[model samples]
Structure formats: structure tokens, C-alpha cells
Target: MNITKYVLVLLVMPFLFGCNSDDYQYPDKYLPNYNFSIDIDMSLPLYTPLQFTANPVYIDQAGIGINGIIVMNTGGGYVAYEASCPNQNLDSCSKLAVDGIMAICPCDEAEYNLFNGQAEGKEYPLKPYRIQVTSGTSIRVYN
Candidate 1:
């Protein structure tokens, strides 16, 4: 009975302590969630820039993301983030513009790294979407 109790406590202890309260989660107060799926072909002329590392593109297609979606090639792989500023309310100025390896929000000049979607000196990170490399020449971004 003592050995069986020890085994049960070992199994139950991990489940009770596994959850970390400090885990960072992007807040949804500012940018509302939208369901969208978009695919890009690297062979296409418009998306040819994505073939290179650190090159970011802003797709302004309507109803895709809150404002749009920013896709970038991080050399080793691809990452996609929402194009709106995570720290600000959704406004015309909340749209982020691609500048070099970072995306700059015109509202307050909050720059976010496109590679990892982290904001410069800010607690909130740019909301990221799920990306899948469909093939050698194609990628899909969805949320």
C-alpha cells in the first residue's frame, strides 16, 4: 500500500505543478481575432522578395488580418505576424510598415522585430500566425 501511494503521488504531482502562471500570452484587448488563411508562392514576382533572408512583405488584402498580415523570410524558415501594433488600439495609424528587418508602427514608432515578432522594449509581442511551408516554393499563413 505504501509503494502504490508513492506512485500515485508522483503521477499527480506533475499535473498539479505543471502549469506556469508566468507564461507570456499576447493580449487580445487591442486587435480582434480574425479567421484567415493565405498562401504565397515564392516563384511569383510579387513574392520573390521573400526568397531572401530578412525581407518582409505586407499583404494588404482585405479581411485577411486585422489590418493585414506581415510575412517575412527569416532565412532558416518563414514567420508571419499580424500587421497591426499590439500595444495600440486599431486605428489608421496602427498599420505597421515594413522597414528593413523590423516592422514600424506609424502611431508611436513602436518597432517590432519581424523575425520573432517581439516588440522593442515592450511587454506585448506582435500577434503571430501559424505558418507551414507547404512546399519548396510555397508557404501558407493562417490563424
Candidate 2:
């Protein structure tokens, strides 16, 4: 009886704690796959109060396996994020709207802090992309 119990425990331990690829699935189309630099004009005001849109001003960072957007924060800082919603894996609703210092998802109302990409109401945070600012004019974003 003791040996049978030990065997059962050993067999179940892997399933309970071991890493499994099945438990994780990357986003199909929304996966970031680009890395490039873009020159942002900081002379004009790009963001409105409590609202920002990346389509008009900023440019997409492109590469072999990464896609991301670079935005000039309302407070004159820059922030970049993976174009996928952390709560839901939908591509259409993945864009985040700036609300003060938080990035709010229009889908499930999940809010992420732009400063650190931490979700405001939930435990899961937004997946952050790598950002490098050079000479205070250009920003390079990567996966």
C-alpha cells in the first residue's frame, strides 16, 4: 500500500507542478513580429486630454518577428506595448486608450499602467515591449 501511494504521488507530481506547453498558447495573428525605429515629432501636441490615438502620428516598429506601436505619453514620455490585449486574445480590440497614466482596454475594461504595464484592476499586466530612446528624438521598440 505504501509503495503504491508513493508511485501515485510521483506520477501526479509532474502534472501538478511541471511545465506544460499545452497550458500556454501564443496569440495566433496578434503576436508581435517587428522591431524598428521611428522619428516622432515632439514639437506639436499629439495627445488630447485623456485620449490618444497611435494611427495618425506614431509609426509601427517592424521586423521579422515583432510588431509594436510607439506613442508619446501625455506627460512627454514615450511608451510601447505589444498590440495584443492581455485579458482577451482578440486582435481588433487589442488597442489601448490612454486614460491619464493608465492604458485602458476597450474590450473587458482591463486597465494597464503605462509606466510599468501593470494591470490596474486585475492581477495580469500588459505584455511590455522593449523600448530604447536615443537623443530624445527617436525610439526603437522590440519584442
Candidate 3:
């Protein structure tokens, strides 16, 4: 009986932990180029008192690679993050809503601090981009 049990374990172990030779390859066609920039009009303010909305705005004349970007103003300064959700990597249901001092995603309720881009409820934070604000009429977002 012990010998039969040993044989059964041996047979099941390999099948349970089998290895595949096919290397995991991410489709290159779907991956967008990482480096890019966009220009957002600074005149339009989405939120009030705190002054600016967490929702992403589409800027057509910014540049290639980055047609639309999310701009967040946390009162202290402006923060920019990728429009894509970190949890599911989907662009459709991902958006930032100002909750006190943090940004909350409506889809999964994944919250992030707009001040630092730190995820509140989940481990993974929202992907942040580089923001350059001038004293003029526009802000530049880069990744």
C-alpha cells in the first residue's frame, strides 16, 4: 500500500508541476512607446477651491505617443499619471476622483494619494508621469 501511494505521489507531482518550453512573450504591437510628452492647457481648471479635477483631459495638439494624459492638481502642486488603470491595465474604466487628498478609481475603487501617487487600498499604485508646469498658460506631461 505504501509503495502504491509513493508511486501515485510521484506520478501526480510531475503532472501538477509541469514546465512548458514556450517563453512568455508580450505582444510588441500592443505596447506603446514609453517615452513621450503632451501639452495641456493650464487655463481650464476642473475642480474648485482645491482647484482642478483628477479626471484626465484629451489634448490633441500635445504630441504623438501621448495624445491624452491625466492631470491631477492636489492643491499643493500638479501631478500627472497614466490614464491606464494599474489594477487591470484598462483605459476605459480608469479615472481619478478627488477624495480629500487622494485620487480614487471608480472601477475597482483603487485609491491613490494625488499628493504622492501612492495606492491607498491596494498594493500597486497608479502609474505616474512627469509633469512640468511653467508660469504661463500650459503644463507639459512626459513619461
The most accurate candidate by TM-score is: 1
> What's the CA error at residue 55 for candidate 1, in Å?
1.0
lDDT of each residue in 1-143, candidate 2, tens digit only:
99999999999998889877544543444344444544444434552321342322324435422324535443445566654566666567766666655667788888776666777576456655555665544444444
Best candidate according to lDDT: 1
lDDT (10s digit) by residue, model 3, range 45-96: 6422224545434333344332244566665677765544556544666545
Overall lDDT per candidate, in order of appearance: 0.89, 0.54, 0.57
User: Which residue pairs of candidate 1 clash?
Assistant: none
The TM-score obtained by model 2 is 0.50
Over 4 Å off in model 2, which ranges? Answer: 1-32, 41-78, 121-123
Error of 1 at 54 (Å): 1.1
RMSD in Å for all candidates: 3.9, 8.1, 11.2
Q: Give candidate 1's whole-model lDDT.
A: 0.89
Query: What is the lDDT for 44 in model 2?
Result: 40
TM-score (C-alpha, index-matched) for candidate 3:
0.50
lDDT of 2 at 101: 56
| Candidate 1, 45-137: lDDT as tens digits | 989989999888889898789889999999899999998999898998999988999899899999898988888687778998888999998
